[model samples]
Target: MEGQFTGADVFFVLLGAILVFAMHSGFAFLEVGTVRHKNQVNALVKILVDFAISTVVYFFFGFAIAYGTSFFVSASELSGAGSSGIFEAKGLTLVKFFFLTTFAAAIPAIISGGIAERMKFAPQCFATVALVGVLYPFFEGLMWGGNFGLQGWFESALGAPFHDFAGSIVVHGVGGWIALAAVMLLGARIGRYTKDGRPIGIPPSSVPWLALGSWLLCVGWFGFNVMTAQSLESISGLVAMNSLMAMVGGILSSLVIGRNDPGFIHNGALAGLVAVCAGSDIMHPIGSLFVGGVAGAIFIYAFNLAQNKLKIDDVLGVWPLHGLCGLWGGIAAGIFGSTALGGMGGVTFASQLVGSLMGVAYAFAGGYLVYGVLKATTGIRLSSDDERMGADLAIHKISANPDTDIMR
Candidate 1:
């Protein structure tokens, strides 16, 4: 029985890993298409760089930190659902590499909105390093790693165990917070706001980019949420169904929230996916959709508040869509999941709130520190000249419009 369970875990892990990989292209298209034509190449560069950096950092140390049984202790004693037997083996190492690679790639863009069209490639890449190599694995072990030793606030709240089937808190929350940190450190894009504190409209360069990227993300997220369910082959049906329902819920929610906003139309479905991710495997289909609806509302509101009210420059709306909505998923997991189906404790709305908050504080604080250092040093932002001229022409010496006078 033990051996069979182990094999199933291996299968799900690999499958989930593939699902995450598919998201890179999803993010690429989404981000690039959303930005101005002048900075298209830079947007593409940011996504690719995040992907590559994660591949390297996760392979070398992030995997060991995340799945490693023992960092201070020993490899044999690390945590999470995956087998410790494969912890140090090169083959398993490769598997962990792919799983985390997608995660690492996802984090850099939280700052994307703030730095759009102006950020230098090098600093953006460096930001990826902090999130992927330093921040992610530490918390990942704390949440999902079985032998994590449970020293943090988690132990106080969770006692012997805290469940994160597909990393609503660990993966999405962490990425969201890190992205938020980057936004804060990097600051808003030029012209994002007026002197009177009103926001200026910076429309997405292409509607196709907006719609297609959103669709791609919706598709990729299935892998992100569903792969976690493969752990129980016989019961995979329920798990996958839950994930599917959550997306439907998310879509329906978009209609309600975006009643007047086209942007909401673009993100309503995504909010649903991110919302359901944490509890997809354990929740009933109804619960999944409910969570997604709630998330869509939150995503739309957060983005507006950030732009119109707080004046935070989130170019792609990454912070609200992923960060805030992901938070909804994390807490919802505790509320919606059935302990019976999930093999853990059942949901209690309140306790789940506490769990999600813990994840937010840790990720936000850790990410802020990384950004603070970068801010204090080489400075993690672009010059005003670069901002106005566009990142491609200024940084890469390539103009989006070759017909422009400077290029000619």
Candidate 2:
């Protein structure tokens, strides 16, 4: 019976890994649909390659940094034939690595959208290595892995530990803030701004593709959130319910607030999902709805602020959707996850604030440092000629579709 349960746990997490892995396709399609036709190939290639690099770096370095576990031991130890160590659960640890790795890879995937069209391929790959191998894992260790006793301190000082049912702050917030730094450092795409400080809009190439990406992500997010349980016994229907409620709230709110803008409508659902990731386990369904609605509204406002007033060309508005909304999700966990709100208690607003802010600070600093250094030495942006030609031709030497004349 014990052996059967262990096998079940392994299968559960393995499925989660597969589902999250599928989300990368969603990421690729999202970017493909968002960027212009000239750069569509680059969008597809970047997500896949970045994910590849992330897997290698995270396996060798980031996983160790976050969990203090390594796969350098013998096969016997790894398979749990030897006495239990970090490689416990009869090879389940390795599968767990696969699951967490998808989350780690998402940081680069999120950043890819913000810096798209203008970033040089090699530099972005370097940035990916640095991020997955070091920067992301540092904070990941502090929060999820309990490396430096940050959670312990939060519990002692704030009446409850910071509770992130999934990874609202850890994944989305970190990705969003990091992407913001990259976007700011890379500067706007050519013609995205005028000499007189006015902003110009870059319309998406295909709204249908964008919507497809959203649907794929929305579907896979169930695994992203629910499978944080890591075991069948630990899984909660509440988490699933909250995720659904949050997604709808985001959809409906964005429909109203964004005035039927397809872009905003699609992304608003993502905002709700990002916001609910932190508190899904604790918040009631109604609370989740409110959280999603607020997140949807936040995305509309903040995206406008970042792009228009701030003049920051965060191409996909990732900072608003993931960074700010994820931060809200973290804090919302404290408010909506309270006993008074019909949630399972054991959260404090102060702790949530502290933890969420810490994530933001770390993400911003790390992103700036990594991207800034790369910008100085390796040259992160493409040349003016390359910018004019688009990333498909400049980096990949191909367009999404060949001209009919060329084919003939």
Candidate 3:
């Protein structure tokens, strides 16, 4: 118990924990804001349930699989230094669990928006179980464990080990890829597309929810990035500040690029946050600003194309904000990472390129396989009744409907 909660340590941790907790509300409101007015309650409930499920998974198998003794740490998982995680210290295991469970919880939060207003809570629950319980463990072990882990093949050939400072790839990337798979299988929402192939724009029910959610997310993101250092180390303070810059950079840059574009005010900030997650520890604040700026601009363009042209029906923009920005974060970590900030070992340009590819491969392959199975077996798509009724009231029978006379 003492090890679990010391006064001084708790000071920092509680602050971070509280902020992270607030992110749940942020997810709820943001998702609600992006979905159509008819589905508002559905969006909020999905966020709630995802967190609830994540909490349980975290305490049970997730913590153990991510941090505890791997039931099977392959010989390849051993260190090139001849040590395997076989003898990993108990404390390190706990530390890993702390980082991983938090990370694991975030994956489905992003996915919720993609499959919003449809999927049965049960199917979604099953997918989350597979993701956190089995799928995420494999990726987590592979990326962090390296030679003394399951992904020895990657370590043997990949340049410099897989380095995701704050899970730009692990958390955001995994979420993005899985969300994509879900969105692909689920198809577009009703009336979202035309037989003529024209796209329809369905605004979210609550703009206030979107703004508030973005604000809360911005607040929690500090913990998400700073906690990557796991302590107030020599560089923790700077990393925290760097994260701040990226968040702001994403907002300001988008405003400037869009020149007061109303459609994307909230999205720009999120893009910046995602872009900076990977290299927050190593990159200078100035570099992060530029990187985040690029991410914000790219997100605006990407989102416009998806809704306007591709007609993919990404209700809450799962692709651009999470997937696209996540891709940027991995690459930026490489480009902006300086040797001084606990980043790339050297100041060379080539290292950044390598980091980008590694992040993409790690997330895409694992994410695809996990969601793919569900798509094949359980058939991940939702029935039209669920889509029309809104998932909240339809699946769980929660009465968020505006039409309800008593609530009115």
Please give each candidate's TM-score.
0.85, 0.98, 0.84
1-408: candidate 2 lDDT, tens digit per residue: 988899899999999999999999888888999999889999999999999999999999999999999888889999877775668666889889999999999999999989988999999999999999999998888888999898999999988888887899999999999999999999999999899989998999999999988998999999999999999999999999999999999999999999999999999999999999999999999999999999999999999999999999988889999999999999999999999999999999999999999899999999999999999999999999999999998988888887842887
TM-score of 1: 0.85
Candidate 1 residue-wise lDDT, 230-292, digit = tens = 444534665567667776776777777778465677678777777776776668787777887
In terms of TM-score, which candidate is strongest?
2
* Whole-model lDDT values for every prediction: 0.70, 0.93, 0.70
Off by over 4 Å in 2: 403-408
Candidate 3 residue-wise lDDT at 77: 44
Ranking under lDDT, best-scoring first?
Answer: 2, 1, 3
Sliding window of 10 residues with minimal summed lDDT for model 1: 72-81
Which 10-residue span in candidate 3 carries the lowest summed lDDT? 73-82
Better of 1 and 2 by lDDT: 2
Better of 1 and 3 by TM-score: 1
Per-residue lDDT, model 1, residue 337, is: 78
Pairs with backbone N, CA or C atoms under 3 Å apart (clashes), candidate 3? 77-147, 77-148, 77-149, 78-147, 78-148
Off by over 4 Å in 1: 1-15, 69-93, 109-114, 151-160, 229-235, 338-347, 399-408
TM-score of candidate 3 to 2 decimals: 0.84
Each model's RMSD to truth, in Å? Answer: 4.6, 1.1, 5.6
Model 2 Cα shift for residue 283 (angstroms): 0.3
lDDT of 2 at 215: 90
